[model samples]
Target: MGDLAGRWRELNRAYWDERVPVHLGTAFYGMEGFRARPDSLKGFETAEMGDVRGRSLIHLQCHFGRDTLSWAARGARVTGLDFSPPAIEAASRLATELGLHARFLTSDVYDAVAAVEGEIFDIVYASFGALNWLPDITRWASVVAELLAPGGCLYLAEFHPFSFVLDDETGSRVTHDYFDEGPEASGGPGTYADEAAVTEHNDTVEWRHSLATVVSAIAGAGLRIRFLHEHDHTFYLQRQSLECHDGDIYRHPEGAPRYPLTYSIRAEKA
Candidate 1:
């Protein structure tokens, strides 16, 4: 477990440190909208986890804290955590600029839960594209369960496992095994920040967890599954032929009848 956490920390730090600066400059994060309105959270996140007013919320893998800050503006006592120092620093700065009350921590998820003492959140929130970076969903679920106050809720909206099976390099082709546990390796052409721009990084690593694995892990950690919802829309262009239909939601132009692009689930710790 120590080795796994260490390796994850190394990969996440490298990946996110590089991503933070790029993401800040992009419209994908709605930085300008956030600065102006202070309530500019991602549509997928806002639609799924509604009304956090006066609730204590903890956002895991909260890259640079746009969503966290947005939640704070909506009156949630927010704490955003990320393993990347640059992300935490940027989040803190953004919170300060917006005059939003939020705390940002730079620690691996496993360690951050342990480090933040005598505190439990009313809502534990995470969003799309977060879980893949984690190597161990069981441990991550345990940490979520631990940080959640009794009867508190856990909310997640993530890219569906079905979407991951498709080959993004080729248009709408099923190329990767859905249940495969082998490490999927890649050196970046650029991250999802700006798909049109090509930026090179010598290293990037990620692990994918299946839907069954994710649900079992959360349930195994003593959380009760409330509802699991699947959707055909994605927040980004997953492949060359993907078309954005309603501003943010994207899908294959040719339409694959079998797969969904995203899923959302809510669980309660009791």
Candidate 2:
């Protein structure tokens, strides 16, 4: 976690710090709706992670804790970890404002073990667009394994590796090599939350990981893969040619061949 990945984490911290306020005010996250309803957990995740009512759940790379608090509202003892101090601070504020019980820790995913001083959880939950920010999936899986109790599970929902290989603008071409082991530098004007919002630290580094690589890493970390599912739709608008459905979810337009846009995994420490 030193050298290049460390530098990339620093850059990412800046990028995420700048995004905190923008995301809080954006319609995508719907902070107002979250405040009123306080349930931001996706149906898919909720269904997969059944009965979190008394479970201890740790959310990795939890940006502003909306989803984490959502778990809190559902009766889970929740803890959130992020590298950006602004995000952690904002999450703390949001928890206090909503009167939800949750803890926010500022630490890189690689340092999460030390941040919590070896506390274990019943569930280690991470979601969409989280894995690309991590450079070493093997080490990340190790961290996930370390954080979970003996019967605990890691529940992950993420943008699919196949989709990550395709060009995001058109979704018709392969813009990047699918199997590249890289800390590829990506930067531009806008973010997924708000296409028009301006930011100074828009650039960030990310890595590509194929599905096999992901599965191998998790298995290497002593977790048993319970199930893997790929979906034809995404929770957000990922491509220009994609069509939005009733719930802000997006998929390939009608009459078009479907492609895997997102994937979820359930792995357990046996």
Candidate 3:
């Protein structure tokens, strides 16, 4: 990593490192509840992935391995990789307490191939809010491609980039450019788990990868896209006007503007 990438990683690692405890204790992650009944995967994503029973799966940028272990609960031999040591530690500890057969390791997404000892997985799964933290979409795609075995697939479920351009207050107005403009230094106080929590190491950086950019990057990484599906709903609150129904799904208010709030991509290695 160069100076700019190194700087971004340094800032982001510290920010995420500090938030592991917050997320683990908060209702957002619900560690106790998770241990009782472990399944954090989205229904649609589960459907797209079909059955992962006994298949090897690798989760990139896995924060504390909730979703990773969720897959393990479904019988996938799972491996989780994250840049934060505290997160990896927490994930490993949780897996031990839960007695799930899973592996948690600390590694930047860009170096996942070597970090995993060149192991290949049958399914490469990445979920919501994972992409924006990274600086390069293309390299990320390459890592995913390398992590997959022949005929294996990469399943990516992410928040739609379109919704990101609009103002966070309301999804109606475009407040930012849709194209990449380098990393945005929008670092501030509080983690997403608890927005008002007082904390140190507030500085961080993130990049926005448009729909086209994300799709093109995966295609360029030599994976054949199986399907790309956009949804009208999301799992988290991305805008003030969004409504939470069933306690897990978020959508536009009954009469509010309707747009793709989340999207999923399935690509296979030839």
Candidate 4:
């Protein structure tokens, strides 16, 4: 397991390093608008996370730090972590360009405690397309608990595991296992940020973790679950078949049936 995890992390780092330039130029990440507005926070993040003013936040798997900077903009002292060096470089550049006092560290999330040198944060925020990359939610949860100061909380907004079972290609059929602990490997046609951007590097590995596993992991790490909220809409185009409604929000077309497209968990260390 240790050897597999190390190799998987290397593969994912290479994948994400190659992906950073693509994401930087893609309209999906909205780099231009982020420069103008400086707050790329989603409604659920604002609603569920409340004010981050004067808090210390560490964003695991931060993926170039747009969200991390967004939290900093709201007055949180922020640190962003990712395994990709190119991503950390880009994130640091963005922070300097925007005059935001944010730190970007390159480290696999499992090693986040050491990367931050045992520094405690008031909030540990992971969102959107994170968590699946981690093969062990139990260890991830422990890391989250380790990073937080006593009474500090974790806010995780992720795609629902149920949604992961559905075929994103068809958007109406079950294709993958919901409870599989795996090194689900695949080569991609293109990056999710820009489907048209041609890329030869597509090696990727992911795992499927159920909600029970996630919740139990957090609880076992000694964090009290504050709330769990599930949503029928996503802030990004998770599936090609999903329809865009208002803004960047996407959902199943009318009458196609609704399911929990996303879920949020707020857990606190006592």
Candidate 5:
């Protein structure tokens, strides 16, 4: 929103640019496996979204576009956007490789409406690892409001903020405050896609938007809350002891305790 924020976004952009090459090759993304089962969305996401045949869908912060192309595979006319140019470029190339007709654009989520040339969509979408990168949930929600046609919906699948407060390795206990809205800074060598893999740029800033904060922002932007669903599982290894199942979904190992690890919200423009 200001020069400082712009600089922070740049820092993140560089970090993400670094993750792209590593992500493409990693087993976490499972690019080769993605080809066989093109629609990589979780079971809950598909059920909540229902039949999207012919609906116009825009995926914000759509990394490399597997999920975006997955929507295309489901017959939604899809467009994907990300702040990182390299990510958008990869998405474009992937679309071509999949023989899927879709548009991929490079734009920060805050500037999404203008980036898309003022086009509106039937479904404005985003998922895990998206909301936290944004500094201002209110601004993000406003963009979602602007980009959706009347009666259009915003569907977000994201890691629960509560999950983040817990210890990183075991989900053992709270290691941070749930209410802290941070442009928290962290940096080093690797990414969530492959933690051990080496990389060039690692410094980045992130924010944690609590469930209430996110829902309220969307509501304040004039979107009606349709449903907010919390899940016991998440898509990635956010914690160390989590067990991976059915490809990418992760859960608390066997008989260990469980709490809300991920959530989805379906809100509509009134």
Candidate 6:
């Protein structure tokens, strides 16, 4: 298990290193839109988190700092952390170019917590597709708890585990086990980014985490659960058959079995 976890981490690091450059060139992130509206955050994030007028925020696994800068523009003293150096470099450049006050650090989530010791944040924030990359949720949760100030909270918005169960082989069918523990490998086609572009990297690794495991990890870290909100809508079109209502949210087509598409949780350090 230890060997597998180490290998998975190595694969993820390589994947992200390769993906950072591609993601920067893609339109899905809306670099132009971000430049135009520096404060524009994902609707779900801002709506759920409310106002951050004067607070310190630490964003984990912050890819390229779009959302991190968004928080800074909203008056939060923001620090963005990611393992990929290219992503951190791009994020730092973006923060400078936009004239937004944000700090970008290049470190794995675990090391970043210790490296930035003596600093506590009012909020530890992570969102979409962040948790699965981690091999140990308990350690990740502990990192979140460690950096959080007294009365500070952690916020997460992620794709529901059920969404990962869909069979992407040929047609939509339930195949993969939601509670499976082993590593799943994917050749990088049909990503959330442009489906048309062929990626140079072929394989990436991900772990399957259930809802119970997610909640339990945070609770075990001594954080009190505030709320766990689930929604039927997702921020992106995950499946080919999914119908998009306004290009912002997607849902299954008619008669499709309904399932939670995304979920958000806020946990406070006690």
Most TM-score-accurate candidate? 3
- Flag regions of model 4 displaced more than 4 Å: 1-6
lDDT of 5 by residue, 63-110 (tens): 899999999999999999998888999999988888999999998899
Across 31-130, the per-residue lDDT of candidate 6 in tens digits comes to 7777888854667789989889899999999989988999999989999999988899999999999998888888899887775766899999998889
lDDT of each: 0.81, 0.90, 0.90, 0.88, 0.90, 0.83
Model 3: residues >4 Å from true position, as ranges? 1-6
Using TM-score as the measure, what is the rank order of every candidate, best first? 3, 2, 5, 4, 6, 1
RMSD in Å for all candidates = 2.9, 2.0, 1.8, 2.0, 2.1, 2.3
Candidate 4 residue lDDT tens string, 112-170: 99999989999999988788888799999999999999999999999888987888776
**Candidate 1, backbone clash total:** 0
Assess every candidate by TM-score. Answer: 0.90, 0.95, 0.96, 0.94, 0.94, 0.92
> What is candidate 3's CA lDDT for residue 21?
87
lDDT for each residue of candidate 2 in 233-257, tens digit (9 for 90 to 100) = 9888778878898778898988887
Tell me the TM-score of model 4. Answer: 0.94
lDDT of 5: 0.90
User: In candidate 5, which residue pairs clash?
Assistant: none
Determine the backbone clash count of candidate 4: 0
